[model samples]
Target: MPASHSSYDSGDEPRPRHVAIIMDGNGRWARARGLPRVAGHRQGVEAVRRTIKAAGEAGVEVLTLYSFSSENWRRPRAEVDELMGLLRRYLKSEIADLHGRNIRFRMIGERDGLAADILTLIDEAERMTGSNDAMTLVLALNYGGRQDIARAARNIAESVHRGLLRPEAVDDELFSSYLSTAGLPDPDLLIRTSGEKRISNFLLWQCAYAEMVFIDKFWPDFDADDLAAAMDEFAGRERRFGSTANGR
Candidate 1:
């Protein structure tokens, strides 16, 4: 889509092509409830389940969740292990049902620190759901927008040096093709929970023109209704995409 003529700008689509979410405030939610942070994380997983179904129902082709970031590793080792354990359990048990529902699963980010079994499970899930066309659910685990850009830059430079690509050929589309989300459309809507107003380095390049919505509620409290309301808000606005009010 043209920057000046996106689906929203043209009013051609009922909803966004892709919705990206920064699932924040799990620890704070747990702290407020006087419960362990893992409890909130578990509940956040449930929110993910609801959002997946809701996004699919809302006709969103792709849904991306900022499940974990590179900075997340700075946390205590115990918490990290627990989070990894939760991820393991989710993958071990959820893949079959997700496949049956025809929802394709995709994970972006470096897999360097992940366990062998987890990597195997992720590969299997992708292969099994690769053919599904109903919807796509992307999980950004251990992902960093800066790191992604840097990686792509290194690869592009190498390609140029090897005579496989020309430096003059580098452009927005070409750079995007080098990223992890090479084939996926750029997110049209970005949501951050717990009243966070920052993008937090998520989708730094892809969200250049995305409409952002911040929710006051924590990740665990988000539901289908919240998703619907966000879309309604998006629908009411006129996306100019850097154009003037008349889109000239």
Candidate 2:
């Protein structure tokens, strides 16, 4: 049976095969407890681990995480430096375990801004696990939906300028192929922690038909039960993709 075609509840509704998460509220989680922001970020890693295991258990085929946004560079210099160091450490320590779990790793974002060493590390990780089949874990670092769309548009324009693509032939599918997420399926469910109601410039076009799940739990505080709740809620939704609930 196909992944999305199965339902955990009675096999009636379609289960979300791909789930995208915007992990938010790290600073707030720290502030609420009078702890340093770094503490919250550290605990957030635990949440990531838990979420990954939970996703695997739920049979979700793809899990995309918005790790660091392009705008995050505007944060305090010290904090940004700390985050980079933490990311490097996490990558080094977790790659083996991720590969062992049959997780295909991929990073989505412009690579020019990253340090050459970090870029190489990311490349190595991608190359090492490109053939995994259990599940794919995509980390969106320094990513922005607007930037992705703009890049896709630029590519389309270049193709048209070179007479490779006719302007009249452009459509949704064609435009999407020019994006970084060209060969990936769109997220079936989008979850944002910290009760944030907005998409925050994360997958604007790809999430057009995704069921949204907003939770009040902070990223560090989120756990497997939280994921289950989100999945349950998603299973209850009627995703018509602009059509009626009856699939009309």
| 143-189: candidate 1 lDDT, tens digit per residue | 99999999999999999999999889999999999999999999999
TM per model?
0.94, 0.94
Model 1, residue 20: C-alpha shift (Å): 0.3
lDDT computed for candidate 2:
0.90
> Model 1 clash tally?
0
lDDT of each: 0.90, 0.90
Query: Which residue segments of model 1 deviate by more than 4 Å?
Result: 1-13
Stretches off by above 4 angstroms in model 2 are 1-13
lDDT of 2 by residue, 42-125 (tens): 999889998998888778899999999999999999889888888899899998899999999999988868988889889999
